[model samples]
Target: MMTIMRKSPINVRAAAKEASHERIVQAAARAIRRSGYDGTGVADIMKDAGLTHGAFYAHFESREAMLAEAVDRAGAESNGFGARVIAAVPAEQAFQALIQAYLSKEHLAGIETGCPVAALGSEMPRQAPEVRRAATRRIKEMIDLVARQSPDWGQPGVHERALVTVATMVGTLMLARAVDDAALSDSLCSAALKRLAPSDA
Candidate 1:
C-alpha cells in the first residue's frame, strides 16, 4: 500500500512565516536601491511587502537586520545578472560581454535593479556593521567574478586589472547618470565603451 505524507500544523505555519520573511527582504532590497539607504523605512518596506508594520518585528530583530538582508538580496540579484551575461557567450568573449552588458543603456537606466555597489557604494560606510559587512562580502564576490573572467585568470596582475575595470565601469555609469544632459550621458557611455569593450560594447 502507498502512504501519503502530510505536513504537520507547525511545519505549515513555519513555511508561511518563512514566505513572509522572504517577501519583506525582497521588497526591502528594491526599496533601498530605489530610494537609498537613508530613505528606506521599515513602515514603507513592510507596506511594499503587503505586510503591516507591527508584523515586522516578527521577521527581523531590528531595522538594521532587515537592511542587512536587503543588501544580500540586492547583491545576489546583481551578481546573478553578471553571471548570466558571462554564461550567455563563448568563454573567450565572456569578459567583453560582461563589460558591454554592465555599461549598456539597459543597465544605465536600471538603477533599482542594477549593481548594488554602483547604486549604494557611497552610502555603505555609514550603514550598520552588519549591513556594511553584507555589502562588503558581495562586493568581494563581484570583484572575484570579474577577475576570474580575465584571460590571465590566475595570473599575477589579473586581480588588479579587474579592480580597475570595475572601478572604471562604476564611476563612468555614476557620472553618466548624474548628468542631466542626454548628449553627455550618451557620450560618457560611448567613451567608456571605446576604452572598455570597443566593438559590441
Candidate 2:
C-alpha cells in the first residue's frame, strides 16, 4: 500500500503560475509567426493560451516584454532544429542537409514553426531593441554553425561566405512564400538550392 503525496498550497500555486507563463510565451511565439509581430496582441495571445487577459500582467510587465520573450523562444527553436539536422548528418554532408531541410516544401508550408530569420527578418528593424537584439544573436549563431561546415572553414573569408549563403537562403524562402503561384514558389526554392548547394543537386 503506497500513500499519495499532495502538493502544498505554495507549491501548487507556484506550479500553476509557471505553467501559465509557459503557455503564454508558447502561444505568443505561435501567434507572432502566424500574424507578424505588430499584428499579435496580448489579448489574442492570452485567449489562444486559454487564459484571461487580466492575468497577463502577472506573467509579463508589458506586451513588449512578452514579444521579446516570444522572439527569443522562436529563435532558439529554429537554432535547435538546425543543430539537430547538422548533427544527424556526416560533417561533409551537414551543409547540404541543412540547405535541403531549410528550403523544403515542408518548411515552406509550416511557417508557424519554421525559421524565424526568414519569417521575421524584414520586420526586425521595426521591432523593439530587445526583440531585434534577441533575433540578431540567434541569426549570428546560425551563421557561425554554417561557417563551421564550410569548405573554407578556418579561412579568412569563410565567415563572410556563410553570411552570404544564409542571406540568400532566407531571402529565397521569403520570396517563395510571398508569391501567389505554386510553380513560382517551387522554382524559387529549387533555383536557390541548385545554385547554393550544387554538389547536393
Candidate 3:
C-alpha cells in the first residue's frame, strides 16, 4: 500500500506565505541590483516574483521597508560569499585570494550577483534614511570582515586600512564597469589589485 503525506490547511497556508515572501525579497534584491534603489518599482518586483501588485502590502509594509530588507539581504549574500572565498584559502594567503577574486573580470561582469556596494554606492546617498542606514551597516560589516583577515587585525589602525582597501576595491570595480573599453576596464582592476596586494600580482 502507498501512503500519502497530507499537510494541515494551516501548515499549507504558512508554507505558501513563506515561499511567497522569499520570492518577493529575492526579486527585490535582483531588481535593486540591476536598477538603483530609486529606479526599482514595487510592481516590477511583484511581477517578477510572480505576484500581483496589490499583494505587495501583504508581504511588506511599504516600498522603503521592502528595500531596507532587500539591501540587508544583498549585503548578507555578498558577505557570505566573501567569507567562503577567504575560508577556501590558507589563512596566510586569504587576503590576497579575496583581493584577486573580487577584482576579477568575472566579478566585474556580474552586476546582478556582484557586490552591492559597488553597484549601489553612488545612489545610496540619495536613498531614504532607513535604506541608507542599512547600506552603511553592511559596509561596516564588510570592512570588519576584511579587517579580521589583516596582519594587524587587533591593532587600532587596522580598521582604517580595511576601510581603504574596501573603498579601493569598490571604486575600482565601479570605474571598470563605467568604461566601454574592455582593455581599460581590465587594466583598472589589475592596477587596483596590484596596488592593494603587490605580492599577489
Candidate 4:
C-alpha cells in the first residue's frame, strides 16, 4: 500500500493539548516576571495565552503548579541568554561576558524578559514550596555555571567566588531596577561590572 495512515484522533488531541499547555506556561513565565509571583493570576495568564480561564486546570493542577512551571521556563530563558553570551567569547572571557551581559543596560531595562532570579528573588520565600524549589534549582545552576567559568575553577575558593559573583550580579541588577534615578541605575550597573569582572575587563 502506497498510502500512509493519518494520526489517530487521540494522538492529535494529545498534541493539541500539549501545545496549549506550553502556551499557558510561556505566558505565565512573562507574566510572573512582569508582575511578581504574588501578582500573577491564573486568569491573566490564560488570557495572555489566548485561552479561556476555564482551560487552565486542564493544563495545570493548581495555580502553584502553573507558577512552578513558569519559574522553570523563565529560568531556562535566562540561562540560555547567559549561555549565548558565554559562547560568543573565548573560554577565558566567558565569566567576564556573563557579568557584563547580566549588568548591561539592556538587561536592566528588560526586566520582564530578563533574569528570573533578579526579578523574583525577593518574593521566592513567600511562594509555595514547589515554586521556591523551582527557583532554588535554577539559582544553583546559575551559580554552578559561574563557577565553571571562574579562573579558579576546580580550586578551593572558586565555588565561593562564584557565589559572590552571582549574588553581586543579581543584587546589582535588582538595585539598578529598584532605583527611580536613571543616573543611579547606570552607576549601579557600571560599578558592578568594574568590581566583578576581570581587571582587564
Please provide TM-scores, in order, for all candidate models, with all chains considered together: 0.95, 0.93, 0.93, 0.97
Which candidate has the top score in TM-score? 4
The stretch of ten residues in a row with the least summed lDDT in candidate 2 is: 192-201
Error of 3 at 157 (Å): 1.2
TM-score of 1: 0.95
Over the stretch 69-152, how does candidate 2's per-residue lDDT look in tens digits?
998898888889989999998888888889889999999998899888888888888988888888888888989988987867
Model 1 misplaced stretches (Cα beyond 4 Å): none
Better of 1 and 4 by TM-score: 4
Global Cα RMSD, each model: 1.5, 2.2, 2.4, 1.0
Per-residue lDDT of model 4, residues 79-124, tens digit only: 9899999999999999888998899889988988999999999998
- Positional deviation of residue 43's Cα in model 4 after best superposition, in angstroms: 0.8
Model 2 stretches with alpha carbons more than 4 Å out: 1-6
Model 1, range 71-154, lDDT digits (tens) per residue? 999999998999999999999888888888988899989988888787888899899999999998998898899998887898
Off by over 4 Å in 4: 199-201
User: Which wins on lDDT, candidate 2 or candidate 3?
Assistant: 3
lDDT of every predicted structure (CA atoms) = 0.90, 0.89, 0.90, 0.92
Query: Lowest-lDDT window of 10 residues in candidate 1?
Result: 192-201
Sort the predicted structures by TM-score, highest score first. Answer: 4, 1, 3, 2
Index of the highest-lDDT prediction: 4
Clashes of each: 0, 0, 0, 0
Model 3: which ten-residue window has the lowest total lDDT?
A: 192-201
